[model samples]
Target: MQPIDKILRNYQSMIVSGAIILFCVIALIFAVIPSVQKIQEMFVQVSDIAAEAEGLQKKLNVLNALDEQTLRFQLASVLTAVPGDRSFPSLFETVEGVAARTGVVVQQMGLSGGTTLATPSAAKLSAADRKLGARTVPFSVTVNGSISAVQEFITLAPNVRRLLRIRTFAIAFPPDERPLTVSIEMDAFYEPLPTSLGTAKTILPELTAADNEIIERLGNMELITQSAEALPEPFIGQIKPNPFVP
Candidate 1:
């Protein structure tokens, strides 16, 4: 009903105010809201970083408190008791050592199960072995000795280092009071070392009293195999005043 010019003039202040408010709303939608979202994401990243740092600090503190020598000694004992791989040489040495100590003559030996030339991969393990997390190498050994010596051999075989379990055994009596022939079936246990470490946030496992007792018992076991030779010292190249100058 009114002229355009007149209506605009009458509502000029109100229109300017509305335009300012609309501009603010558009800015909030396009810029301010995005900025707020970015800030929130940054806060989340910082919190994650702080948590990771705290976890790493706790691990460092635990490492610092540990005695390296004692840990290494314990690890050596444990490895000797239950080697990380199927060490056939050490296993044979252990069996021979025990038989020697028990006054038994080893007549024959043969590997019963699995390939003796190479270690079996984890994929080749049976479901039960995978679940148990330990692989077994079955072998059989035949020995000739007096009844008392054979009994002692049987007793000592499982308790020696390079851990073994007697699965089955049979004895044959000779007619003329000769030494008895004993056939023993055994299984040696091995476990592979972990291929990867846990995440920084993962909690370190604490050794319980039972674990300590096991370690102590392993330490006391007779190590039949010879100790491994110490590693050679690392070579340090001659230092030059300027490494760039050949």
Candidate 2:
């Protein structure tokens, strides 16, 4: 038997309470849910940054183990053995030294077309070819020596100051008391060293067993001059006069 007006007022309050509850649910769906998703995304990004930082720290640690000066010297030796320049005179001197050591006499030498001089065509090469980062310069040389001497020269080619790969070999046995005439075709490779990679970052994954073996082989090479005092002039004198100099 409650008054009708009082019952109506009570119903109004209930409706207001329900409206408030509904508004709160809508806010959670529209606002709070999106905020939670954003927080999760930020957490993922932070995790990625942490992983990247850890990887960089590992790389820095690897670089810390190297002796910068010694690495530079070793790398310089390797690159010098296979120079980026068209240093024909240095190549010739290297060959002559090897022949002398083997008691052989170089009778004739001829360079291939692309190997002798750089032309306009060199600039027009495709991007892929240019990006290969290495080029082969080929040449042919004839020498006169005993078979044993020629064998010794072949054995020693890998240990020479300049990197030369024997591509073709032929021999003509002259009559008795005459030395054997040996013909050799070789490929000299050239690859530029990036300046960004100094002695510390020059090599990655550190030098492996095979890499150390190669370093050992190059280190054993009997260069023309070892002393710092004797290195400059002899090296300067040996390289070809710059063809581009007008």
Candidate 3:
């Protein structure tokens, strides 16, 4: 009876401690571990899915963009000409073609400082073969044509191999004897060589701009974005799931 009592008293604390530890372990495995493991697995799977989807989307975009650019591209071209070598004949010929086709009559053409100088002499020379003036000659072209024909001529002028600019256009609103005749005064600007893109970056003294706000904004870096078209998005999120549970 005495031995049994002594053993029970001394071992009582150990027995209680062991019971508490076992209960905690059971609770952790049943209640906490499953939830933690599920969260970790979900996170890993979601990350993998997101990565795959992103890669696929990028590939599709690249392929589609390539196809579009190759087949149907609409881009503006900056005219390049052999500056001083450009002659009035070629420029005049281009105007003549457009004007004649559009039913515009050229009454008088001359070479002058501004875009408008009526030059009848340019008709005799060839485009690549003629030189209107040394370096850049300011010439004027006067055409007796309708408003539509005049507009067509201006549009066609830039498409010519030799660069020409519409410095000023003066239309006969009240008009002379010919009511449909609108006089166009344009400058045929020719340089020695097509100015380099880098050199063109700088506005030269001879170069001129119009009061039109749109033209003033052309090639202005302050008004433009110079970064690459295609770029990557930055890191957005970082989520960590329980490691021990998995």
Angstrom error of the Cα, residue 212, model 3: value is 27
lDDT for 168 (candidate 1)? 95
Please identify which of the two predictions, 2 or 3, would achieve the higher TM-score against the true structure: 2
Kindly report which residue stretches of model 3 are placed more than 4 angstroms away from their true locations once superposed. Answer: 1-80, 83-86, 114-135, 175-177, 193-246
130-222: candidate 2 lDDT, tens digit per residue: 665556567888999998999998887656767788878999998798999999988665654332444432335668899988887877776
lDDT of 3 by residue, 197-241 (tens): 343223323223452232333222121112212211112232336
TM-score of each: 0.79, 0.74, 0.34
lDDT of 1 by residue, 93-211 (tens): 88888888999999998898654455444437755456767787789999999999999999999998778999899999899889999999998887755544567577877778999
TM-score of 2: 0.74
Off by over 4 Å in 1: 119-123, 126-128, 193-208, 226-246
TM-score: model 1 vs. ground truth: 0.79
Best prediction by TM-score: 1
Q: List per-prediction Cα lDDT, in the order shown.
A: 0.81, 0.71, 0.51
Ranking by TM-score: 1, 2, 3
Which scores higher on lDDT, 2 or 3? 2
